[model samples]
Target: MSDTPTEKPSNRPSPVIVLVAPQMGENIGMVARAMANFGLSELRLVAPRDGWPNDKATAAASRATHVVEAAAVFDDLRAAIADLNFVFATTARERDGFKPVRGPVEAARTLRAQAAGGYRAGILFGREKFGLDNDEISLADEIVTFPVDPAYASLNVAQAVLLMAYEWRKAGLERETDIPFTGPQTVAAPKEELHGLFGHLEAALDTRGYFRPLAKKAKMVDKVRAVLTRPGFTMGEIKVLRGIVSSLDYFSPKEPRGAGYPLRKAEVDKQAHPARRAEDAGEGSDD
Candidate 1:
């Protein structure tokens, strides 16, 4: 098989991110970073409080300089989205009119569909503190609300833009096929090998008296088996863990009384006076 993977180009045009009366330079930069993260470009600023070409914004954007440098500034909301055929206004509060409302997912889907059909689209983000006024929201084609806690529904301007942009990118994928992995490939361990590991661990723990209160031994063993089995450990992982257990067993310092005595003391210390042990240890340590 060829080592080089094929590149697929998207047919849909990315939605423009428009900020209405944004107050902070840092926030705009963060918005640019979020846009870059999800592959969306084209930034439009409407009457920014700190003005355009802000140094703070450029500094905060870090590697997303293209989005920051190419950002366009406009005088008002209407002028900001004038060239776009479809626009979505993000809001946390309810509006007075019967304007159609959509969540980020639905809005992204519609935006993608519209963009594919050769229509320009954009999403409007309001100010940080009070958000967009009624008139500003009314100018957009639809209102977008996040499914958030009603008691505290506010989201930062950059964060709101990130959510919408992320959804828009996610809507275009037919399947998730770009996940990365490292190390040599191996199949999961066979059931017999897993059973052997369980038995080996149980035998070692039995010698160490790990299952306390004799009556609860069976239940504890079951719980231990359940945890070990859930991960579906591969043969490589199983061998590594077995080797670790063996090395631990070989190198472990011996207690004078018994293996279980130190464990019992630790449990008692944890339940009774947690800080007492730490203080005792600190007194003897050179550091």
Candidate 2:
């Protein structure tokens, strides 16, 4: 253990430590030690390279046995992050796509602040060699990195996690704020409600012939659901969307297929490609 004295953490909720596709057992143990040092108890491992609970790891976490004992293993990154309301991924290199990147301090502030708001926030640490993949980064709400000597900024997995944990704990102690995201209770639309809204959307789209080319309908709808499910829509937005669907259904003329006949290509096409319909209708003036 480093000789540094870690301050007693407040009752504030500690951010979850998630290892995504970590390569080494030693690194995993070190990450557990880091979390334990800062009063963080939850440790989640996602598809580790070396099988988990290895003796080498237990030896590494000499004093932080509790962290090792309580660590949870996950088959995939998404499952590991399922419970986290706010998630941040840690990486040394900037990923290609746009995602808010914050230094350890900024990330600590954001995570702690979000936790104060009643959400459980998690920080994802990827493999030592490649770091987080683009698909894994997509799971995070933000990205966090530590500032080292720019010329030599490459940090190993354990070191990176330690730095982040240290900064986060320090910030939580120094800024005595009243906010902490309580247990999991994000205001996202309930699953049942969202499912109902999806049904309405499918029905509405069917009326408009949006799902044409029979073979593609299922795949397209699945993609739509996947995208919408990831962000977690809110009740109000779901209701609004349902209302829009209803209005579209009201205005849409029924297809000639028997009243009970399943929706067909043309109807789906009309609803899906409204732009084409408007073009065909020749609605008065050009924008």
lDDT of every model, 2 decimals: 0.85, 0.80
State TM-scores per candidate.
0.74, 0.57
Per residue, candidate 1 scores C-alpha lDDT tens digits across 143-253 of: 999999999999999899889988877776653233223455568999999998888888778767787887999999999999999988999899998987787666766
Worst 10 residues of 1 by lDDT: 1-10
* lDDT score for candidate 2 against the true structure: 0.80
What would the per-residue lDDT of candidate 2 be over residues 105-185, giving only the tens digit for each residue? 899889878877888999998888888889999989998887788798788888888888877777765333323333445
Give, for candidate 2, the lowest lDDT window spanning 10 residues: 174-183
Q: For every model in order, what is the number of clashing pairs?
A: 0, 17
Candidate 1 backbone clash number: 0
Candidate 1 global Cα RMSD: 9.9
RMSD, one per candidate, in order? 9.9, 22.8
